[model samples]
Target: MFVKITNAGGYQYVRLVENYRENGKVKQRVLFNFGRLDLLKNDPAFRNIVKKLSDIVERTTTDNTEAVTIESEEDVSDAVLKNWGYIVFRKLWEELEIDKFLKERATRGRKIKFDADKVSFLMTIQRLIEPMSKLRTYHEKNRYFGFEEDIDLNQLYRCLDFLDSIKEDLETYLYQRNRDLFKMVVDIVFYDVTTIYFESCRADGLRNFGFSKDNKINEVQVVLGLLVDKEGRPIGYELFSGNTIDSKTMVKILRKLKEKFSIDNIVIVADKGLNSRLNLKIIREAGYDYIVASRLKNASKEVLEEVFEQEGYKRLDEKSYLNAEEIYGDEFKYKVLERTNVIKDEEGKEFKIEENLIITYSSKRARKDKEDRERLVSKAKELLENKGSITALEKKGARRYLKKKSKTEEYELDEEAIKKDEKFDGYYAIQTSKKDMDVEEVLGAYHDLWKIEQSFRVMKSCLEIRPIYHFTESRIKGHFVICFLAFLLQRTLEYILRKKGKEISSERIMEAIDSMNFIEIEIKGKKYLIKQRTEGGAIDILNVMKIKGPKNFMTYEEGLGFIGINK
Candidate 1:
């Protein structure tokens, strides 16, 4: 409880009271305001007496304060949270041997901005890569964040410009080691393609209007293909024209990576958008094993016939029924059906929307299918009802009345039903290509593509990867690179928190960091200390990661730990 005290001079005083009950008896205490107590200097002794009395009165308040101690989930101070991404980036940068990797490239001098070594370079990269906020506000009260108001804003812009120049160098740095970095225990590599809409419609070199996935035909967009390792850290990314087909992209990116990085012996995983015959051809020709969402309809007639002829594939709820058991090399088996539906619009031209039933040998796929079936049943029933209504309206005597028509009379019908055959509920034909793998494992691998889709959601929602304002090629690249980095850092923090079974969002982590009040407190004339007040949960997370106090902030020595740094 808070109480306000006012003097004749209009000065206000605030006091806090704490109350508790012990053994069915109530206790009350009061705490005088520090600044307010000092202001009552006219009667020094009397003021001192009042303060002592207030302290005794305040004993009850301390009881509740001591009862619950908040925990610090992570040392997510503004500087730490903001720079945490840079730390992980530096780690991956060194692991991938980006510096030595860059030196070998003949075009290194062409992009002088990226080729050079500057502390600002890494810092700038870290800044852009930070999660999305219109303007960065980190540790404003902490002077150590080193934001000097006296410094010209031009200098900050220069830093941004310098960082923007090395866009390609940064890409090459990460791309060159794509495979070697994941040579060990790399179980899953998620691949995804998404479009970023731009403000301008004019097509330059790389920017063009294609299929706007966002349904914006007037807006020019670019297609971005990204690859991430099992740990959810980004490995590489490629930018292509918006019209670029997903199926055609994998081979080009893979070929570029194979030639540039000298990589082999890796599994390529993608969703249905990338499951093309030509793409599969390239995957096979390149000597790379791939797990793709097999298009049953696209399978060869011989393969489909083989699948249909195999009586073992039809077994259900047994080892063969949409469940996993060892069959192929550490794999499982399941069955699925390709489904298609015909549609006629206002013009009566027929088209079809093909779908698939992805049976799985694994529980993951089964659960997904179960949920999908539930949702589909709900939607399909609704659609059928809506279509039934339209059919009923067309039948004679179905309507209650008819509106006036200049030269026509209307007829109505009762109990009219749709004319379409319900037997067509299930349609289309196709089969899986994974003859060697179990059906469950194949479905599981294919559905895992959802992880990449989730990543795109984070990129757009958390990082604001779209709605780019910059028009120059360098600025455009810089903007995306930064958004990516921010995502990387945000994901890293979430990963660490999850390991401890604690849940906190990247935005909340930032909010906790912001809640901190860093005061330049002077206890006495001669003693000064910088105090950081954060909850206990936040600190616990930070301690587990060995990031505590002011000392853990990155130092030159830590940066030197990265490969090929010229300290």
Candidate 2:
């Protein structure tokens, strides 16, 4: 690398340029720019330093190329080392090949201020390691080792816009890459919807007030639908308006998968929230199977009676029975019944489809449900005693247990309602079109939906995906894309750890990664970086992730190499 001077804006600027080869052709990359050559020329000390540099280069090019070492006799201090956990994440990023993919796709014209791909990479890494606002990321960018990009706040926002524009293509590329890397089996996929609320009270077309999964009902939100493979790896996602219900998103997401991914013959596993006659018919007509939780209380009277009178219940485990043989544990007993249902098509045509309804009674769930109802009943009684009228909001909670007399204008406990609710306690059912698979397989597949739910939790709690600050629709979408990519990296790390028999939680992994830091010290004109190694889970994380921990001490340049920093 050598300094090159260029005249621009009636001033001369000195730029550090390096010659490199790309596509079998020579190229030059401007590494750094020192502004205003006149300032350097006016300083005698700077001119002397330039003369020394020129002499060194001339001697190195001549036959008298001898090794020159500088011995520092003066005492030196003031050296510092920063966190290096990002390096490990960088390795994983490269292993996933996302860096290369983004580099190839993140193209721009010649007038750009910074490399969009590099900015995007740093932004994603920041989101994963230390989530912050774009401004904060820009201000603290230099704190991260090897993240020396010269990007301003405006450039960062522009990069996000670029990311939003290429979101679809990027997701597709990632899906295919993951499939090849993990050998993903697309036969059975799990899907679920979650709501992420915004902090702003002002509602727009995309951020209208709706039901919040985080219980932020007063705030606006957006619904996010995530699809994952059988192994719980994310495949793709869709964002909907906050007012969009869970059931309404299934068709759109399914259609996207079918059209974009061309995935067919897969069984979609979801909770009862997405269960509807229309969704079921759509899944069937599209030649796909579904294993969805059924709202047993909402079933027809015949189905309820059959569920109550079904006698051929089987024990799922040997220790499932609490009282030896007579009293079975609610969680241990399961009964499955095969039934053919007639449903109407969009054209009013009737069709018969066979499905398996597996019902399991969980004593734990029953106890919790009973306790919850009793608490609500007590709250209702308290309200009645206080002569309080049930408002519309109260009707959604404890008020549901009370009945008001029209004549007396008084409230009383509804015995019939309690009894009806108690009858369904401890009973949960799952419906599946997979007739060939056993009840255990169907139940197991349905249970894996928890992974997708956990992924949502990670995005919201760990990554802070909610309470979005962006107002524009495109920026909002772009923000979610970053969150999704961070979630993908998190899931990929978990997958790698699990494959190595390490079974670590996402929180624990993040804790370990965040704690791996280094401290630098300088003495006698020599720099030293000491790894502040702690005796904790971080060590195990480094080992399991195959990341190199810092040695006793290293020079400043050596420290950079340790963290995979090219400079």
List lDDT for all candidates, in order.
0.49, 0.75
RMSD of each: 12.5, 12.8
- Mark the regions of model 1 whose C-alpha exceeds 4 Å error after superposition: 1-144, 147-188, 297-310, 314-333, 336-441, 492-537, 550-567
lDDT of 1 by residue, 1-567 (tens): 344454435565434444556699976443333335345456333333344334433442366632221122121111121222233334444455644543454244553333323223243333434333223322221122222223332333343454466555665555445444434345446787889898888887667888877778898888999877655666667788777877667866786557754556566677777866556556655766566655554555554554445354443445444233432223334456554434454577655434344432333443444565445445444544455443433212323222223464432222112212121122222223334455445555655666677778777765667866666676576566666655655565666677777777655665444433222211112111222344435565555455434422123233224212311
Clash pairs, model 2 backbone: 81-520, 330-361
Candidate 2 CA-lDDT value:
0.75
lDDT of 2 by residue, 1-567 (tens): 577899999999875455767799987755334457887677433433334344433443463533323223123233243667777677777777877776666643434456776787777877887788888988888767556667788888877777788898888888888888888779888889988887798988889888887888689888899998776678999989989999989888888788888887889999999998788888888889999999898888878887788587777656435533333244556888889867887899987779998888767777778999899888888877776456543556887878877687667888788899989877889999888987667877887788888888888788877678888888888888888788888888888788878888888878777666555544444555556544336766677777767665456777778776411
Clashes of each: 42, 2
The number of the candidate with the highest TM-score is: 2
